[model samples]
Target: MAVIRQLDSLAPDFDAQLELLLAWESVADHRVEETVAEILREVRAHGDVAVISYTNQFDRRQLQAAGDFMVSASELQAARERVAPEARRALEAAAERVRAYHDHQKQESWQYREADGTVLGQQITPMERVGIYVPGGKASYPSSVLMNAIPAKVAGVEEVVMVVPAPDNQISDLVLAAAAIAGVDRVFTIGGAQAVAALAYGTEAVPRVDKIVGPGNIFVASAKRAVFGQVAIDMIAGPSEILVICDGETDPDWIAMDLLSQAEHDEQAQSILVSPDQEFLDAVERALEKLLAELPRREIAAVSLKERGALVAVDSIESAIAISNRIAPEHLELSVANPEKYLPLIRNAGAIFLGRHTAEALGDYCAGPNHVLPTSGTARFSSPLGVYDFQKRSSIIYCSPEGAKTLGRVAGILARGEGLEAHARSAEYRVRNK
Candidate 1:
């Protein structure tokens, strides 16, 4: 049985225990940092040679040239055809829904004219190129391809370059199919920090991308951190998390399975349940013990539950919401009757799954929302990956002569007050002499 922690709001040390539970240090290992720094430097200095050499050594592939890393268009098409009819249909359906949802998030350039004919507003444009790193081999995620690439396409990104490690030249057909469905412009069989470096600093083979986005192992995460300013990254995501706020009305078995879904993501993933019903919490715990034995990933889920999972018994549903807001989980499920009534009370959460039937797993795949969420309590300030992330906004201010003269005086005053003489003079030049 998983030794998941049980907490009560009435306990004297509950606050301290909660704090400890939520604490997760995202600090990269010093050795990993040093190694990433060396790899980045070599890639920057040597270009394609360094990337190709590292890719061959790390992925155990025997590629003669950097060009060999590129996965051809014909290959993608073959992979799409290789998929079973039912799976292909599911992928197509999911891609369509994801595309439809993100289309709404696409920002268009807008401007408003002032009385003096000054146009002021914002202009939105997608990045010229973007790189998406899809984890391959046993960790292949076709859903990730759809979630990351579809949004970039929806945002009108000119090129979407994808990199997936083909260890021993083995690549997942599902991933390739997903890429095809999502309209990825390019694919490279490169992984680790080298792939990141190649994307950040353009190599002879891999074109430089304006931004890099996707999830990977520790090395990929460190490399992303090292090359942040050189190129934009989606987010340095932490482990997956799910916090289910149930009012004891939802099925105990359903709640237990929902918690396990996140727990099975990895040993570090967290799964927590907050509810007012102590008896329901007990029922869920029993369900976890019984159902966990049946899961293929039981060991992983067990470790996660034993180490990071919790069942918090709160005084009321309002108390549960307050705790959830403080935790700011990556995914939140309101498995309660009248879930909509509690929506207003939720201030922070990467994604909110309302009602008893809406499982967090749906949001991960076909629920129409992007599942790439802000983890490690970052939902307090950050958001899920969307079209907005792939787009850039520029402030537009085309001041008319009359408007400039009127606004320049105000700007000059503020600049002078701040002791910026050059700024004051620049503004003064636009002001009327009177």
Candidate 2:
């Protein structure tokens, strides 16, 4: 049987156990930080030379110049052609759905005039350029390309520069094909801290971007942290997580498989089930044991289950929800009969899987919602990546002569109270003599 822990909400030590289970420190180690810092400094100083050197060393590629790292337009088209017909169709379909979904998230400029003839509103505009990092080699993710690039395009971003490490000069054609479909403006075969540095501080070969988004290994994560002020970045994602709040009505096999889906991501990934049914929990436990032997990633999944996974028995569905809110998991599955009824009670979650039929895997792919989400309980404040992330908003305030005069007295009083003589005088100058 799997070594998953079983707990009851009524237990005296339940709170402490839950806290221990939820705790995870995503901080990069000192060695990684030191390495990344050195790379960032080198890249910032040497530009293309530093990038070329690091790419050659890390990716085991023989490159004479930085220009050779760029993937040509013909290469991208060839990748698209190389993909199987069925896979191409699936990619196109998924891209269309993702594009359509993010279209709703696009913000537009809006203004309104007050009675004093003052115009106040907001203006929305897209970032000129963005860099997206796609993990390469055996861990290639085509879905990530569509998820990151499509939203930027939908938001009217002019350039989407993508960087992926081609280890041993072997790149996944699926990833390249997806990039082509998503309308990426440029592609570079570079990875790690060097690629991030190239994007943050532009080299002659790689242009600097307004924002950098996507996932990478520890070195890349540290680089993103190191260069935060230089360019905007997406959230520092932690391990994948899934919290299933079942009502004991769903099939044990289905719930067990759902938990495994997240656990298979990695040993650090978490999968938990909260319900009021003890019998149902036992059934799921049995199902887990039976299914664990079948999965290809069973070793990793088993380790995750033993370390972080849990089967918690609560007093009621309401109690389960309260616990879930405290956990604030990355992916939440309301596997109960009336999932919608409980949605309002969910205060924090990166994404909410609505029904028993709606699997978390769907959201990762063709479900239309951007799967780039807040992880490690960050859903409490952060949100999923969307078109808004690619757009910037500027507050618009045009004060008419009459409006300035009307508001100057209030501003002058506030400025004087703050002990700023210059500010008071500036506002006083705008005030008309009565």
Candidate 3:
């Protein structure tokens, strides 16, 4: 039977056990780094031809030219019409919800004037173009297309370029339709480190983007890391995570399934449950064993739970929340009677699901929040993807004649105190004989 690691706060070495369970270190694989470096170099040197060659070799495709895989407007339209009515409706609905939620996150430029008419504020500007990568190796992620692209569009990004791997020259229609709905300006059938390189440095076919945002395998992550200074990138996400704090009232079945949701993502993903009731933890474990047999991806989830998942018995609900904050989980679920009572105590999390009915999976799909989130323990400092990621802020300062005279004197004194006469004179010149 599949079993998740169990812990009790009353144990002598509980803290140590928890520490061991939560420990996640990503050591760089030298081979992966070298491979990505070579791909980047080739893409930079050969441009479109390089991208074409890499795609053919990696994705098992036979392509003649760079334009062979460029998705045209007609193809996008065809995809929109080709999808089943039910699937198309869900895509449209999810896209609309994502767009609506991000619309509220849009920032505007603002300024304020002082008595002397010295104005100061900020200007919000969208990036000219952005690239969003969608992983198409194991499964199709139309939702990813919406989550990454809509925010940029809502932030007023002019052009959105998307790249997805089409292994065997087959891509998903739903993904294409999603691109249409999310306002993606361009779509290309390419992925992996080469796709990242193409986006980072302009190729003959792929235009260089100001920023690249999305998730992918290790090759993509390493590529993004290698090209950090060349272009901005979203966070390097780790394995998916979910921490559930229950009061022992929720159905054991539900809690088990919630934990499995993260587990099914991969072997590294973690699903944790914390509650004061030891019997509840037992019940969840049994439920997990039962559910594991029924899942299509049972083997994957089984390994993930056996190795990475956990069930902890806390002293009380308060203690459970304390442990949660310390973990800084990516997804936190308060599956208790009154979930709001603990909101003030939650200082760290990428997203919070309140009450028993709010499944973390809902947030992953149509919950209207960006599913792209800080992973591992990054929730302690980072945040969920939003419109802000696609936008840039610039400080605005305008000094009036009188304001300059008053400020220049202070600036001149400060500059000279630092022993830079050139800087001091520049400031003093502004307020000279005022």
How high is the CA lDDT of each candidate model? 0.93, 0.93, 0.93
CA deviation > 4 Å runs, candidate 2: none
lDDT of 1 at 373: 93
Q: Give lDDT tens digits, candidate 1, residues 88-131.
A: 99999999999999989988899999999899999998999999
TM-score for candidate 2, residues paired by index: 0.98
Reference-based TM-score, model 1: 0.97
Task: For candidate 1, list the clashing residue pairs, or say none.
Answer: none
lDDT of 2 by residue, 1-434 (tens): 44688989999999999999988878579999999999999999999899988888888988889778999888998999999999999999999999999999999999999998999999999999999999998787999999999999999999999999998999999999999999998999999999999999999999999999998888998899989999999979889999999999999999999999999999999999999999999999999988988999999999999999999999899999999888888899999987888889999899999888988999999999999999888999989999999999999999988888878888989999999989988877877553
Arranged by lDDT, best first = 3, 2, 1
- Candidate 2's displacement at residue 348, Å, is 0.4
- Candidate 3 runs further than 4 Å off: none
Can you rank all candidates by TM-score, best first? Answer: 3, 2, 1
Clashes of 1: 0
